[model samples]
Target: MIKRLVLLAVFVGGILFTSSSQNIVMDKSNVEFRVANLGANTVKGKFTGMTGNVTFDPKNIAKASFDVCIDATSINTRMKKRDTALKGPKYFDIARYPEICFASKTVSRTGMNYKVIGSLSMHGVKKEVEIIFNSSRNTLTGKLKVNRLDYKIGPKSGVFVGKQVDITITCVVE
Candidate 1:
């Protein structure tokens, strides 16, 4: 029993020493999002407000953790009328759900990026999704494209705007 206990303690200590944790560092100047109206050459709008954190251990991705949030009201399509409409119940419903969030449950390293399995909550609904992201000391960027309809997001179009929306987030790892 003593030998086993000692071995286990050493193993746990080694893991803690090998892994590193990081925090989310937004550039504040480099955050944006674009939404389209489909088939139209014109892209609808963009969003501004953003904040989050990312913890990682490249050598040990299993030790990684992440949480991100975006301000729903910050959405801007260059038109106040359209932006306001987006915040309504038909779309984001900002009053009922002011923030879109993600919390990672597991992290696995694959190729050049890490695959994160997490719960994404938006408009008062939560779903599991995977986010592929690359993390380095200089910068960490994550790009995940998910359909609004998957989260029961409003009456975009029965035609299906590709059934997937592209989302990309870039931030510094602190």
Candidate 2:
């Protein structure tokens, strides 16, 4: 009886250990981004077509990983003319770069939050950026803003209508 009980405990413990290391499947529907442009006025928008995978271990950040890709052509600014111009070659150039991507290289724990460093690719240019996110075993979400001029998306203007752009992302994993 003693031996049987010991064996049962060992088997249950093994199951738990293996389950934690298994690849976590994050639901794609839980992911989204909000864009806000704060300049002469506050212009807010949102984007769909968010697709990504996240394999994370709360105990060990080195083992944590995430990859997200956004469809550039799905950008919506609520203005038909501005949206058309945004997809032009001078801006996002959807013909040449149809996707905006992010792949994390490192993650640092900060209490209940985490700082993720990754490469953000847009307009065929990749740049390293750090974003802070609230991470838990069940969910991870964050926000970031990128300027159009930083990636050379649009031409310079004396009186800029919009300059800063904000992005927010949220996700859930099971």
Candidate 3:
């Protein structure tokens, strides 16, 4: 009947839309950062426990959106002492603010890649940041530089830990 045909079309459209957007697979995703440790060496770390929703369709970039949150206490530098300090009051202060989040305001294509302008909230401070990323199949990789001082991650006047932190995100959606 005509009514059944309409219902079938609607159901198929819904399924197609749902298939385009995906939730990040935490076990397969990685968020890593690198920062200069004093005048000695570079400290590399990674955070686990990321949760997010991503809606991306190359043909419909106007409707793309990204929203993600990383667990603040999940910082792991592979060095217990450093990780503990970073979780303390002078740094992330995870006891107070336990999440680092980002919500995109805009997403646009640049050449073969895309850039997302969003508000990155961390260490109890929120700042606007731009992330450049590449998408291939079911994976997305993004990179951005974050100024620790801007987020109050460490002492205001000290440079024991470099201010600029390079963060890379590799996410697989399912």
Ranking by TM-score: 3, 1, 2
> After superposing candidate 1, which stretches have Cα over 4 Å from the reference?
1-21, 27-35, 42-48, 160-162
User: lDDT values of the candidates?
Assistant: 0.71, 0.70, 0.88
Give candidate 2 misplaced runs (Cα > 4 Å).
1-38
Residue lDDT tens for model 1, 10-104: 99876664464555454441335444565454344555555776667676666677777878788876788877887998888999999888889
User: Model 3 misses residue 31 by how many Å?
Assistant: 1.3
Candidate 2's clash total is 0
Q: Which lDDT tens digits does candidate 3 get at residues 141-164?
A: 999999899998887654578888
lDDT of 3 at 45: 97
Better of 2 and 3 by lDDT: 3
TM-score winner between candidates 1 and 3 = 3
RMSD of 3: 3.8
Q: Candidate 3, which segments miss by more than 4 Å at Cα?
A: 1-20
Worst 10 residues of 1 by lDDT: 26-35
Cα lDDT over the full model 3: 0.88
Highest TM-score scorer: 3
TM-score of each: 0.75, 0.74, 0.88
RMSD of 1: 7.0
What lDDT does candidate 3 reach at residue 145? 99
